[model samples]
Target: MHLFDKEKIYGDRLLAVDDRDRNVTYDQLDSFSGELYRKVGGKKLIFILCENTIESLSGYLGCLKTGIVPLMLDSHIHPSLLNGLIREYHPAFLYIPKTCIEKIEDSEVIWQFGGYCLCERNEKMPPALYCELSLLLTTSGSTGSPKLVRQSSWNIDANGKSIACYLEIDANERPITTLPMNYTYGLSVFNSHVLMGCTLLLTTYGVLEPDFWGFARKKRATSLAGVPYTYQILKRIGFMDMDLPDLKTMTQAGGKMPPRLHKEFALYAKRTNRKLIVMYGQTEATARMGYLPADKTLEKCGSMGIAIPGGRFWLENEQGNEIIEPDIPGELVYQGKNVTLGYACCKDDLIKQDEWKGVLHTGDIASRDSEGYYYITGRKKRFIKVSGSRVNLDEVERLLKEQYEGIDFACVGTDDNLTIFMDQLILDGGEEIIEYLYQVTGIGNRTAAVKCVDQIPKNESGKTLYKELETTADNRIQSK
Candidate 1:
């Protein structure tokens, strides 16, 4: 079913609360969206520079209603990058803010929507899009790669339904916006809540900002979603001490949270009679594959839990054979209807059908317990050979986390050494941790060093920018 199809039934229900604290009803959304649909309908491809604003979201929903495929992109993207994408994709129309309009001044303005402008290209359109292709989203990075994950209407519907089912979302639930809508996880929150007639609380303020919690409290938001990095910031700001009586559930994803942090939040949720749900997925699978039940948080502390409804998880060996033995680590795999059509590198790739079938090889190293719960250990590509022994960098980082409670560490391996970067200078036992790593791994102490920085570089979702760390490591090796 279409996402907006429910608006007819919930016409007068409040659909969303904007950053300015303005409430928008379903009737208002439908009427405004109808106006937008008429102005930009029948476009083959539309590029939307999206923010968490009602206007952007309404325009997006309108595109869906009119069967216009939209490529949702971060509004804060650089002008050079936007130009590069436009040159590569040749989208028929661009819906962007008026402030960004000057950057693409060569394009002709087709329509105006208050603070935004819709620009059109007079040149030849890109190749014909596949019949089922509905949306295009960039992979989670700022590398300016033309690569985008192609998703179908089925993918969106299945994922949204599964999320709503497990989260028990309904019309009364208000989920606060904790991430950018361009990101798959963040976008899924919007999709599922909107589908269920739930209210969306929108804001651009981060966890560190006082306005974020203020808005959440003012709106009486029932749910809050965040990446591991968001939780880290929450913990730093003493989230446990905050009086959030109305908050009913908290969800986390994006990356593996340290086990300690997981337990800490689980205990808090248990004590406060709330739920702290942990979920797992990638953009390729349309945002969710598995979710850890809140009731089992203490029992399955670090587990990624079982697959979500309508999805199944298994492990595969290097030979592509299924791993039946429990507690044995292997590459995690998922089979679900939410799997995307495939990746698109250029405009021509949009015409291709589903290449993944119904399966995805999630390149994560994980082990399933006897109860069928999955626990991600590390990534396949994030490993290196040190002293003729293979060592997963994430494993080393996990070890460091276990040893040091509150410190942030990123491990990267060079040709001759494995370096651990810390976000703060530890006055006590930093050397001891290095010695411990050398002792445990048998890698020489001389081959390992610890460097301190003010903070670790991370994207909006709290994912470590390992490429940046690799670059720093390479430069340090070169300079030495």
Candidate 2:
């Protein structure tokens, strides 16, 4: 069931096409990967700074094929952050773009190909990896953190098969990349499409760029994958009116899409005779855990749908008892082969065996309808008591976004203090927003505050940097 197995791939078919119009075939990809694998010389751990390029992808496949564990990271990560990871993991090798070779102090280039090079660490010792350890991925918001989810080969294989099965992907499918390869959702699309022997349309251009759509049209890309922020950008850029007869499917994951946007896309898909599939997943699940069927997209507008094929979902109350009654919020739980082994906080933790077994207690609070569709209510940790009354921070953000439309709002605070951060341009409206929060959450005017910043901070994946906001909140309180 290995994705790169020669017998499973159509040797002559195009494996990927980059923005430069460079086409790579399956056979050529395998051959190039074999060369990279041999250059490793039995190294067990490597850090791959990933871009949506043939060279980056070849290096990744080579590691998987040869049982060399790789920690995929964004190629454009800050130098200090990258150095921190290098010191923590002590990878024996680094497969990175040629331009980045000068950034490493004690590394020597051992091999080069297609603008990328393999550099061996001169004074580093490779850490011992668990026998089943297949890959390492940073949580979407923790790019600089040493913590990484530990996934197994079986996790990748099972999740890939499940995604392909639900998406109905085949060799004829062409999915244009709209997310970074380091992100779990983006990586899942890559693995599943490759497993199905489909041609991947690789591009560094964003959805806002005209060149991106031009390349998609030229290649007749049949599918598109995006995160919640990507879809928002697409809507702003008039994606519904775009002409692309070849596009038959659109997939969204990475976070909860606003209900309004979700309905809009679902209706657009129905009108255009295309499929809009909404999915739910985490790095802990190796990619995907649930997907709303395309046919039910509009019907289950806000739901994340049922568990993926071969996966099971349930809700557990505070007492750890399974909640069988519908429409009651509880901690969401998932059971499947795709659930990853556990998290690795340091090099020594890499040798640890599976700790979660096959079950993952997703920290999301969700409710299942009578029809068995699951809808995320909020996060367990996202709730705070305002004057002894509980309030959901996510719900506050959602309420503001839904009412304000174009304005961006992020809610973060302690039990009795809720601070809403908005752009400096809307500082005049701060009082109005505070009043609105009081009306909705019943918090007193003194308990709620509004802070205007240059802009809300976000990670590369467009998720809000709540940790940064929390730190700012703490400083503000201390100063007061």
Candidate 3:
């Protein structure tokens, strides 16, 4: 039986609840899934513009129930980017907000409900997808990247079960949404909770919004999940002062939390007798690969903890030999059923089989303690996490160089902050350039900055000196 089969859900349990007080039970959701199945017909692939709403959840669950591969995208995805993906993948159907209907061309709406519409493409031929291909997710969240992680049913099921097992999730737990469902971390929370028949408290309001807390309190939310940025906002807003007696669990993932912030939350969790789980994961692993047990939160403040159920982690040095000594940094490698099939950049790639098997080279450099706890020290890839979304520095430079011809661009910075050094001549266009970066990368001014340099530092080999640029960026941040 499918992992999400209705028979597996607890009988008559509320499946989801929204900020507007709308609720649906498992039976009701199943009925809606049947309706969606009839409308979708033989279509094997769908593009779903996701929101934290009952309609969006229904459509996603329906897709899973009927064996349709759904590529979840941010509901507010830029039009040109979404159109480019539509042209590239040629999805047979689209489940999108009703307001977005005008944005899609040559599509006819077949069904409408709860501010969303299901549209069938006018010119469509179902791509020959691999039988195990269950879902596609953007590699870079909100970056409008066409490259997608190909996840099989086993990947999702294994990861979801592992998360549920480690978190001790039960039917009575209620998890409030704090991140966009399209992101891997958020999707994992959604899928794992649904697996255990928990009432999902859905809201688009962020942690900064007062209404979000009000909704959480009113609904007696049992848990909350967030990224480092979300926890930063929570700390700024005096999360410790809040009186949320019902909230028993909190989870942090999607990027490392600063050491100081991790300590603060760990202390708060300890004082309040609530569980705070620090986790590590990637889209390539479906979702979670490791999670620190809540009991050890304060004891191992900076650690990402041990591997989740059904997963194992080890460190590999430059020579591909496993590191046996503690506190020796190496590329972290994970072996688990959750490891995804591979990536797909186009429709033709969807037919490919599992290229990764059950092992993943995480590209993250980390070390383990004597107690077997893992701590991330650096990243081997030229990527940074901005607001929990992975941003490729090379891709950012390429985009800028392509848009502004003749300008030399070098991008460097730490998590949540990206500095772009450009040719001094474009100093006058800094505002426009930053706005363009936001449009393409979904990185706002708060997280991204532009600095004009006389020339991009390069060596005799003509390769940009990123380390030197990083030092320069560090000095600038410190001076500020």
Best by lDDT: 2
Whole-structure CA lDDT of model 3: 0.85
Q: For residues 198-253, could you state the per-residue lDDT of candidate 3 as single tens digits?
A: 88999988888899999999999999988766776788799999999899999999
TM-scores for the candidates: 0.95, 0.96, 0.82
lDDT, candidate 1, at 362 = 93
lDDT of 2 by residue, 424-444 (tens): 455344667767766876776
Question: How large is the C-alpha RMSD of every model relative to the true structure?
Answer: 2.3, 2.4, 9.9
Estimate candidate 2's alpha-carbon lDDT, on a 0 to 1 scale: 0.86
Q: Rank the candidates by TM-score, best first.
A: 2, 1, 3
Distance from true position, residue 154, model 1, in Å?
Answer: 0.3
Query: How far off is residue 202 in model 2, in Å?
Result: 0.4
**Candidate 3 TM-score over all chains jointly:** 0.82
